[model samples]
Target: MNRCRNWRAAAAIAVAVSSWTGASALSQHKHVSDEELLNLLKDAAPASVFAGATVLNMAPDGTMKVVREGNNGWTCMDPSGTDPMCADAGGMEWGKAYMTKGPAPQRLGFIYMLRGDNGASNTDPYATGETPDNNWIKTGSHVMIVGAEAKSMIQSYPRSPKADPTKPYVMWAGTPYEHLMLPVK
Candidate 1:
């Protein structure tokens, strides 16, 4: 009789432990909606309008500030803030269009872009063709903050280089275009 009671008690504890573990996993993978993400950005950062662009103000939190020129392109503030980063032969590939959009609720990761007109080609005249994978922000498992249009561009872009004849442009922040990736608690 004592053996039977001990067995039942162990079974109950096992069930409770299993339930708690499942709940914790579910919370970790919780999907964040687009609107919810935007609200999170607004609440976490001080936003401001700059020259027809809505700049999501990132505090002096180790990374530099980046600005979007609508969907046209993106530019970074010079250390002095007087002149814009140059669109050299390798133009900025990650523009405002690539940073704002949040990932679909079903997706696990998000991407952000630096602004430029050179499409996605590294050899293009205005190519700032750096991939999101190379960006400092995409290094870890932190939540990514991108502009709405930029997010859409990344989601729509072809995943494989051979799949599409045209090379999709890549964008990087912090070289000339600075973007931030903050850890989400």
Candidate 2:
């Protein structure tokens, strides 16, 4: 009887190990490569409109950073924060998601920013509520985790830009603002 019990226990252990190995193998195939991720970004809508912008790499924390060639060199900008160009909100959120969750199969998040044909410029077209300056365009749907996360930090303003009790705040979405989330693919 004792021998039978030991055999049963050993069989159970073997099954458990086999199950674990199979699950691990499945997970390995699900991982998306950095190059593939970059290609996805290149194919995104508004991001593709930019002249020579390309997807960078995933940061250690999971946030991806992208740099595009301006007239001069490479420039990275985030027009979502109060100090959009310098703020780190987007990077932080991306890192948090990556640390808490494993790598995603597709690109995650969207960030809207101005890409200049010539180079980096100090113009705020969205701020003026007018057409963007020449050579400047609102670009979005990129795979940069940091850039996408930054869009979430933009502030919504009141209709009057002052004390309006009814319509408290207004924020542009899908147009001026960038939408960030996991891609279906």
Candidate 3:
């Protein structure tokens, strides 16, 4: 049953991924001071995660530049002015796959968004705004579980397009990029 749903969801997934702006392709439209960028760290992840996480900033044309080097394997950045997050190595791999429209990696990927997200279409990975049919949801402080492992965990939570943003649910459910969204706030 899930296989059938996954197959049907592929076309939509393809459409969504084409418009998604990933970490590497994050747009920096306006002039932002380094201090502001660095300050975003506080809300991006827990103090422990950000303390040793590498900091990255994207240029106006979507070029990624490293701002701070850290020993831990995690990376922290604000993909857009509104969305700040921290991702471990596995999460980074999952993101790369999402950007390239490839298969999810086998390992589990974790991400922290303590500050909260602006909003996104629950059914479409890259729908920038709300449409008549697209389910747009803005989740407050949450952590994401991604990659192939996340697919297996979907059956344990609600997969509704109209997911409750404050609960544990599957975002982009039925798609290759589907993942677990556990709200923390």
Query: Pick by TM-score: which candidate is best?
Result: 3
Candidate 3, 7-57: lDDT as tens digits: 223222222222332211233333245688889767779898899877766
Per-structure clash totals for the candidates: 24, 3, 0
Runs off by more than 4 Å, candidate 1:
1-50, 62-158, 161-166, 169-185
Q: Candidate 1, residues 1-185: lDDT per residue as tens digits?
A: 24233233222222221111112221222233334333433332213312322222222222322333232222222211111122110112222212222222222223222221112221221223355432211121222333333344455443332222223423332122222233332
Of the two candidates 1 and 3, the one with more favorable TM-score, higher being better, is 3
How accurate locally is residue 148 in candidate 2, as Cα lDDT from 0 to 100? 37
Q: Could you give candidate 2's per-residue lDDT for residues 29-128 as a string of tens digits?
A: 2223555444443433344333343323333333334433223112123211111111122332333333234332222333332221111111321232
Q: Relative to the true structure, how large is the alpha-carbon lDDT of every model?
A: 0.26, 0.27, 0.71
TM-score-based ranking: 3, 2, 1
Ranking by lDDT: 3, 2, 1
Please give the range of 10 consecutive residues that has the lowest summed lDDT in model 1: 81-90
Q: Per-prediction TM-score, please?
A: 0.18, 0.22, 0.83
Query: Which pairs of residues collide in model 2?
Result: 71-118, 110-148, 110-180
User: Which pairs of residues collide in model 3?
Assistant: none
Q: What is the lDDT of candidate 2?
A: 0.27
Output the worst ten-in-a-row residue range by lDDT, candidate 3. Answer: 16-25
